[model samples]
Target: MTHRTQLNQAEEHLRRSRENLPVAAQLLYAVADLLVDAQPAEPVTNRVAGLAFTYAGLAVLAQYPQAVQDAALDRALAVVPEARPSETGGEWALRLRAAAGSVR
Candidate 1:
């Protein structure tokens, strides 16, 4: 499948399965979807989007019942220190941590 098609599928899956996920997981997935959906064109925008995607995905994965390897969370944790405050002064890393903590 084309890259855009794959992204669309992933977004649809997230939307359909969201109710089954913890609130935090849903939020993180939403962030991931948004980052990919933007289809960033600039180099810097692309880099930021890639980081957001990895951070969001890893945060969600770390919340799973059986939880993936510690390396996933470690990578996600590494991304947090690089996060800059959003234009509205919100912190994405904090939101990600809250979501990871919310997993059952």
Candidate 2:
């Protein structure tokens, strides 16, 4: 391949990688938040919708999840325009320890 073509390919790969990162971080923390700490079945539909919204938002912003691909980016973007990463290794750590204790 020409140098120009190689550069384009590398740029595309970097674009996709940057787009995907915050999405994954948001999702891991969201699942950890709802499933790990709270009882999700209490409100039923609303709680489920909240989870779905979270996933949709992340996929729209990050483009990582396969399910979001099926629904298309527009659908995901309809609920939330963007997603951001969660806070880590701070006061939140204390809350988790209080709830479930340490793995190590």
Best by TM-score: 1
Assess each prediction's global lDDT (C-alpha) against the native: 0.50, 0.41
Model 1 — TM-score against the truth? 0.33
What are the clashing pairs of model 1? none
Please give, for residues 4-98, the per-residue lDDT of candidate 2 as tens digits. Answer: 99989996775565444434333333333443344432322444436654653564435455764444434323333222234332333233323
Q: What lDDT score goes with residue 29 in model 1?
A: 50
For lDDT, the strongest prediction is 1
**lDDT, candidate 1, 1-104, per-residue tens:** 89999989996875776757654455455554455444323223436656666665565565555444345445444433343434111344344445544554
Compared with the true structure, model 2 gives a TM-score of 0.23
RMSD of 1: 11.0
* lDDT, residue 68, candidate 2: 48
